[model samples]
Target: MKDQTIEDWSREDLKNQWLCWIDTIDPKVSLKEGDSVVFPKKRIVVQAEMTPLVKSIFARWERLSPSERFSAWEQLKEATKEAMKDVLPSCIQCGECCRKGSPVLRVEDLELLRTEKIPWSALYTIRSGEPVTSHDKGEVFFLVDERIKFREKEGSRECLFLDSTSSLCTIYEDRPLECRAQACWDQSGYLELENQPYLTRRDLFSHIEVLWDIIEAHRSRCGFERLYGLVKKLKESTAQREAEEIASKIIDLTSYESHFRSFMAEQLNIPFDILDLVFGRPLERLLELFGYRIRIEKDTKFIEIITQEGPFHEEA
Candidate 1:
């Protein structure tokens, strides 16, 4: 019956349920190894009962309205203020924290980027499935799920703002909200920040949401998603001719990327760099994820592709 109940609980159902309370048995209360007490009208289950519950809640959070999410974000900021009251150790300039990874950008941090205080090239987004350190959840209960985070450079996990010689953040005065809130030595501080709401892509960049939507539409309408889906299918299929045909189609579609670029520029007035920042770069990353390599040569309008351990080149 417990298994059935678990199976029947949907992601939405889990979001609505909370751990109301748990029993606290006195230290002097006698009990046997195999014995259990029956509450007259209630039932009890193991602590592990909450695992799937939390997972479900986390997964479906994207379905929440923007207003709902922002409200939660505000609450978290208030909690962080309270958490900061705890005694935190002074920084000794060890550089360990700065070395670990870049401080992720919060909603308030976007202003720095908008003002060009931080260059876009120095920033990258860890998309929904990429591995990331969940500072909001802490290391002890580390979340191994895809939550969008604004990371620094690809090669070095260190923050771009770190000054190597001084072992201090170069942009200390303009550091992100997470950076200001962090307390490396305080366990309770970590716990307090756990499960706090994060800004969604839409929340941070609503001005570009229309562009994102258009790119998404193009991805669906064009064979972009289908091309990758075919690649996965080709990997599992036994037929060689079918595989070649799919690979050929994939190469053919690569040429259309320019058309997409032109269409966006002429119709939407978005420049090449901004388009690349918002969509093209991430699209390339997505293709790379599907075990395909794309090299675009703008000088000659050339594209190079490798699939099935072989090279394919297309020219515009």
Candidate 2:
């Protein structure tokens, strides 16, 4: 009778008969050791593969006194109620998605920029081949194409347009195309994002002759491809003099890039902070993407490349 009473609980049983608080756990897998879950009368240990749970040993459970069964039913009722409370019908206006990552702009948002509803300072460019973190993959990879994205608030990754106190979007009426399409409760819209064309830096500024000329010149001198090649040269140089020469070239490029951004901003009345839209990230951060770290001393700057052996310093 003891052996015959135990049986594997079906997922349907969890939903209907068992009322097993199936909301939090994956019902597809059977419960066993190492899995801890609140059952009707107990906290059961479960491991799906090895020791499948004897979750429906009805005869053994019936051995409990009437008071114990009453207490167990109360526990199950409360757990189910707690789990059901978090299902939201609509957005809570918490700005969690905006805080985690600002929406990537698309061609549709161009009108917003023209109207100055989304100010220029609130945007930044991710240049072609720049290293960017992928939230889906949890790894860094080079961006295949250039993109214009919203800038984040200072000292945090929250969207620049977010009003922190009330968790409201500052430009909700003229929010970016991606912002308008997103519905966290629904997943259907996000797949469409993958197929949409992103807005580009050239799309925004290439029409202006003077600004475009300077931007083109900067990309030629300080682009990720050129910088990464320099890093490779620095690492492979066998002689100290050759390594020093490579470092010097990198230093010259960095100096020239800095002067370029400052001068262009002043000439065009662009905010200094928004220069990333004009010229990708600063050379220092670009170098970091190439496996190099930089530090400054009294008069000298040091660039260190990390390798399999370890990092070795180079004076620039």
Candidate 3:
């Protein structure tokens, strides 16, 4: 085949060529301060100083307009055809995560699974608005409110679509978004492990932090409105008066219990756990610090805040 000139190549052609060039360079080449290489086959040029050349290309690419970026990418590709194949590393499929019950399905995933006729059991109960639990040990699925029971004995622990014998997904073409979005070991060295193909808690926590930011933004927009509606329903019910009275008594007991524990702790200088044995939660400590005084009247729960000026009442 006749070699194509870089000047006559398309943007995609140039990119492919550049990637090919980068892939072909010997790791032992030891790129130095001043050196250059020319690929006559691809009709492209590359410099010896790896750091400066890469930095310049990336910086210039960042400053380009979207259309110009495409042009520059093509130019880079034409300049480095040997690097194209090195874009992503290979994956050795072990399917450990698939077998170990790590498949996380969002609500949208249900539609896909239903369409595919995948045999997966729903983990939640709609009644009581709480997660169902195992008959043996009452542990709820924290996020899903579903019990953690598997579909069949074999399919229960493994991903519904995973084929154990082949170590491949049966529904590879129609897998859920989570499966498609996951790029394990892309940045971290976790994928390098022979036994472990999963991310650790630290990596998962970092992902959760990013998700929390998104949740916080959404909450700022509409969380209060939803809470207000719930509160309003609680306030209007016939059981509202009884509930408020119970809530008031509980609050006062909680407040006094908190203060009493703190007083004991300060006087004895013991660890908070000892106090926790007597009284649960930081709310007790908080009540002591704030000097909580609560009073219930008719259907209203009142909180009296003691200030230096005087005491003031607030109704819930």
Best by lDDT: 2
Per-residue alpha-carbon lDDT of model 1 for 26-76, expressed as tens digits?
A: 112113464322221111211122235334435645565656544543443
The regions of model 2 sitting more than 4 angstroms off are: 1-86, 135-139, 232-243, 290-293, 304-316
Q: Ranking under lDDT, best-scoring first?
A: 2, 1, 3
Give the local distance difference test score of model 1: 0.47
The stretch of ten residues in a row with the least summed lDDT in candidate 2 is 41-50
Compute each candidate's TM-score over C-alphas.
0.48, 0.64, 0.24
What lDDT score belongs to each candidate, Candidate 1 first? 0.47, 0.64, 0.39
lDDT tens digits, residues 1-316, model 2?
Answer: 2233113323333234443344444422223455322221111111111121233333334554556554544554444444333334344455766776787788878888898887787777877876666643446666788888887776577888889887788888888877777654443465577777788887888899888998888888778777777877887889999998999888877878788788878988878877988887788666765567666789887777654442221100
TM-score, model 3 to reference: 0.24
Q: Write the per-residue lDDT of candidate 3 for residues 1-316, one digit (tens) a residue.
A: 1486544455445446555656675432212344322222211222311234444555565355667655666555543433322222333344544554434334445556447454333221121122223211334432222111212123255664567687676767666544554432231232222233222122222355643453243334323233233333434447857656644654554555446556656755546543322222233222322334455589654655443331111100
Tell me how many residue pairs clash in candidate 2. Answer: 4
Q: Which stretches of candidate 3 lie over 4 Å from their true place?
A: 1-92, 117-156, 187-316
